[model samples]
Target chain A: MNFDNMRFSKEHEWVEFEKSSEVVTIGITDFAAGELGDIVFVELPEVGREVKNKEPVGAIEAVKTVADLFAPLSGVVKEVNTQLEDNPGLVNQSPYKEGWFLRLQMTDRSELDELMSHDDYSRITGTE
Target chain B: MSEPKKTPLYDVHQSLGGKMVEFAGFLMPVAYGSIIDEHNAVRERVGVFDVSHMGQFVVTGTDAREFVNRMITNDCSKLLPGNLQYTVMCREDGTVVDDLLVYVISEDRIILVVNAANIEKDYEHLTSRKRKNVEVSDVSEEYALVAVQGPRTREVIAACPFFGQVADRLQKLPYYNGITFYHRGAEVLVSRTGYTGELGFEVFVPAELAVALWDQIVVAGEDCGLAVIGLGARDTLRFEAAYCLYGHELDDHTSPLEAGLSWVVKLKKPSFCGAEALRKEKAKGSKRVLIGLAVSGRNIARQGYTVLRDGREVGRVTSGAFAPTLHKSLCMALVDRACSAGDGQFAVWVRDKEVPAKPTSLPFYKSRAK
Candidate 1:
């Protein structure tokens, strides 16, 4: 639940660095999953698919509704969460942990600076 | 945000942390906890739904049956007191306006419950075509409707100290039967029919007493596992049960025959709203039929998903969802006449994704249902 080291978006996405220099992990914000009930399916982008910042790279569907997962930064999709196809409720149970949507091959790592910080995203979503 | 409209049971759902949604202009609880949890509660034990948004109208006086027989497609002349039947209000062209339940409470009085979105429209239609001997009026705002559905509904009612009689009526009553009965001294009309594909009852009571009734029922049934359901679970439960939703399956553009509900229509009648039209359509078989499609891929075929044959668009997906009961991608699609696509020979173009699907029979999870 702590978003201290992350950068967030108004669309309810978060990006964080994976210990390695070029790797980035992406997931939908808690607000998105809560607004959408139990997640039923997630369509992740193919590996090596280049995506622009804020452009949709994948989708998430819940029992009653559906939402788009946007690319937090312009990057090539290094990995997509395949496990979500069978158990999409992971987003509802643990959207931040096991529910991470995709991993990106970051093109411009500095784009993270433009995203809202933890405190800023919390205020924007009004979940503060 | 604008002020969220509240139902008669608004406080009860919110107090239990319900997620609210605007459906047919009313702020209604779509779910209390998890949708699947609430859905399963209805199938296994009992679940209560605040269906006040659905409109109710009263038709009374000397010629109630005559008025209904002329307006709706079903024959009402044979309906005596304490009888109920599922009927459809249709346009002159035989296209369904809205499917509803007609309750003949007495020789001179009857109550008609309609879909929430078609309240104003159905009311206006009834009033404009007023019968000389029958007085028709919309009494939706003055009433609140509640539904207690599932197999163990009777057990839950017995827990209510004042509901001994209600429990008995619900158990002995046959399907499609209704009675203007009493509940804890307050008179109500309980009908033995529901959308959940189970033994259930729909209660119509005074709007002012709605909240008290919901709380009383909840407290009485809590130990028996009666959950408070919202629209979210309602849609899923109905879909899993293969029940047709008005907007999705049957619309102004879709005919009753095409929607596979012609059983409710009586063409034997001398004359009703759409008898002639339906008779002609019957001679010339319907162009399309509503069939169930269970998909294989994760890309769900939603409301407007295109159905493809030979990779070309054939028909459209009317309503689709992640069916909780079957735990698979399921949809209801209207395809070309007598779609010959064998068991596993169909696909849906879901947002540029060609997802694998097959034409499966409805009620995807019949074995587990109540």
Candidate 2:
């Protein structure tokens, strides 16, 4: 399920921006996290790292395989989810909340206009 | 979603929240919930897996017995019609093509189940060497493979509606044996074989009835505490069983003798593929031996991580993981013949750190092997 506050990307990542601040949070959608299965390690980008839109910024390692997390918007990393170093499953446990991968200071707000809304994400997923 | 390809229990897996992944061009469940949870589920209780991606082949004709005996490492001549054997398809240098389960269905017919990734390679390899009358045909896409495994798995099979009579007959079935049976209005072919160390059954049925049959078994075994397992659990369980995972443990470049599978080579089984190479290797002794590693701490040594002796690379970890049963790190690797037994453990160059590890006996995790 997608939310109005959450923007979806074709690569299955989601971004949520606070209404008043330019700071935005990113995480994989529940669908992507579920598909990855039992993340054993989470490699987070360092704070102040510049990330390009749709480019790999970090990685998630599952028991069976490994997947890199992509930045949905061009931004400077403001904060990294440090709790993930020991407990990577937080991404699978609450992907939209505490499971957030990074907080970024958005450099391009215009990128949000190109993202898919809840309905488009639902269609892309082909299910609720 | 547009009918790309469906495993026998694809629908069932979806309904149960299986997270599907693209594997070898087939849509298969990587896990249902948490891989660790699913992994533990199969180790502790009865679990079902949709292994329908495995390729099955049919070989039949007048020279079937002789052809199969000369093709694989196992002694096919001694295999009763209904019996099965775990064997390997090898190369000229004693390298294993694939480890497979071969079953003699009748005097003139036999079946070989192979890895999905090696279907074409195995088919082409087998066909290149023609026998007098034995015709080899690929029947992989036509059959659905389902595995029900764990300690309590026997109870589930015993209670399934159509398999009761056959289950009775199967009760006496020893390891590496198989039989064709009727189950739930379907022609069910079952083998007493499994990758997991737990007692289990692998069934092959027509693709058309795969989903329904899987559902019937699940619905029937509900009272027996059966959980629909996934590939995640299937892998972890097998890894814990110390089973040699293809691609990781054995490959075209690695020989059976080096992979610690010399026992299955049936070196005495006259004139099979790579028999000469294997005999030669046996005489010379192996230069590298595949061994098990145990990490004393919680840190895991993953594949591609280099094994170290005094900070120098000695070998590389081929496969490593947190074994659910052992609750510790277990790994398999090919190490140099000169390396002495690790004094209980050693170090692995994992990422930027030298992870502490120990050399454990074969099969880092042990279950019902006997």
Against the hidden reference, what TM-scores do the models get? Answer: 0.94, 0.81
C-alpha RMSD for every candidate: 2.3, 4.6
Which of the numbered candidates is closest to the native, going by highest TM-score? 1
**Each model's DockQ?**
0.72, 0.37
Candidate 2, residues B1-370, lDDT tens digits: the string is: 2344677677777888877878765789887777788777667778888899999999999998888787787777887878988888887667888888888999999999999878889998888886679899998888998888877777788777646677687777788788897655666698888888888889899888787668767876787777887777787888877788788888888888888888788887758889998898889888778878886554567787888766666788888887767767788888776673454346787655688777778876666632
Candidate 1, B83: how far from true, in Å?
2.1
Model 2, B147: alpha-carbon shift in Å?
0.9
Q: How does residue B216 of candidate 1 score in lDDT?
A: 79
Model 1 achieves a DockQ score of: 0.72
Give the true-structure RMSD of model 2: 4.6
Q: Which prediction has the highest lDDT against the true structure?
A: 1
